[model samples]
Target: MTGELREAAEPTRSEGATYYGRPVIKEPVWKVPDVPAYLYLGGMAGAAALMAAGAGLTGRPGLARAGRVSSGIGATASVAFLVHDLGRPLRFLNMLRVFKPTSPLSVGSWVLAPFSALAGAGAVSAATGLLPRLGWLSSSAAAVLAPAMTTYTAVLLADTAVPAWHEPYRELPFVFAGSAVASAAGLGVVAAPAAQAGPARRMAVAGSALEVAATRRMQRRAGMVGEVFGQGRAGRLLRTAEALVVAGSVTALLARRSRIAAVASGLCLTGAGLATRFGIFEAGHASARDPRYTVEPQRLRSR
Candidate 1:
């Protein structure tokens, strides 16, 4: 029988054994409204910070302004989502109480604190024409920090026990980085002037290409756990994200001379990024929900 037929004929249990419907791995308690939003916004802000610096250096004032605004807003939203996830805003302070080099969350909190301030300062300076020099300094600093800000979330997710997430540790960082770039580039394509949006359009294409490649690689290497990404709701979302990314990339290439095409491509890429994030999250959730994912992997590992 084919894999799909076998799956249809049998429940997602390991080798005719069952765990009495109990999950072998505990499901993540992280709320959907919070963690996925944090991941998306944090990545968008990080990529925007890099774009802001690049645009400023290249003398594209309009694009720079768009990047600055996006970085600040995205950073703020990311923090809000994190705080909401924690259930108490004040609990965020505990994250700063110490620095643990081994802890991705600890490192992320530190990175976010300064990144948020710098991005905010840059945005304010652009908006109010105040402290231009300081704004330049902040934007520059943010650019340096932005890469870590975007990629550390991958480390955070990979550090987890969930098979779907932890198994693809090598590729998740690149996947997230690509998604971040695509999202920020999409924002620029939508908000920046046509003349200034050239780099953004190029970035959107490049980033989307990287995201698609990395995701496919991850799925291929994910072994039995990879099935989660191809089944049920997660599969639908992943398929949708892939379609949108392809469509957006093609539109971006063709958008060089058309503002309407640029806008449409921007919307498509942004939606693709969102769908990708949610799909990954749901895949992890589904993997944890199924005992086979947890048991089968370990059973193989022990041999």
Candidate 2:
């Protein structure tokens, strides 16, 4: 028998089928249904935190109260969806039992613990109409948690076996972090006037800079794995995000010319942030679809 035939005898593809290259061995553990729901809810929580902070800064007690309430509701809903997706809700508690720096889930659980606490405090402060009296302390706490809560999902996904996610680890966190900042800025613009939104605009600009830099780095660092960012659905979403972020930054910087332009900039930045999350999720799925992602990485490690 030929060497090809011998290799074919133990085919990589499913039984009774013959293909030259390896077929998919492991499929994506990250379900499609889980991705968007998680991303949206997390962003919502982050946005609420930003809004609450901006309200506190601008002396808008009512907006601060509303922002806190919204944050709590978002966090609660996010937890519900996460548990439902896991199928065995009890496993979530076990996630908190230990700390492993190498395990994204463990780290994320820790991040969530404080995030949830801050959200609850914000909710209580708002519900009791006490945020004004508590001063910047409550808002400051929320601000600190906002970025972590918003960005850690990227790490959670990256720590997994998925090739696209794992390979892009360095840039993924920054991508999510940038999105969080931009999303927060968008919320600030909607909740506060120009006086307070100035800081938000600056935040958005910083985020855009980070996002662009991280994306370039991802393209350079990821060899064949990075192909997803330049092709298919993932490519399109990324392209759109790039355009939106750049345009938004320019408008924000030049918004002194027009208020309508400033609003448009905020809208674009918000849209870009959403697109980045969706793009990353889609790229992970694409990477999982091919067996190369699974077998190659393992084989490399073994060697």
Q: lDDT per prediction? A: 0.89, 0.72
Residue-by-residue lDDT tens digits, candidate 1, 1-303: 998997777755544444656787789999996898899899999999999888988999989999998998899889999999999988998999999999998999999989988888888887788999998788889889999988989999999999999999999999999999999998898898888988888899899999999999999999989999899989998899889888888888777688888888988988998898999999999999987787777878899
lDDT of 2 by residue, 217-279 (tens): 886676677887777998898899989988888787765456887788878887887778778
Q: Estimate each model's TM-score.
A: 0.93, 0.78
Q: Which stretches of candidate 1 lie over 4 Å from their true place?
A: 1-21
Cα deviation of 273, candidate 2, in Å: 1.6
lDDT of 2: 0.72
Off by over 4 Å in 2: 2-25, 43-74, 88-91, 123-128, 131-138, 254-259, 294-303
Error at 22, model 2, angstroms? 4.2
Clashing residue pairs found in predicted model 2:
none
lDDT of 2 at 48: 70
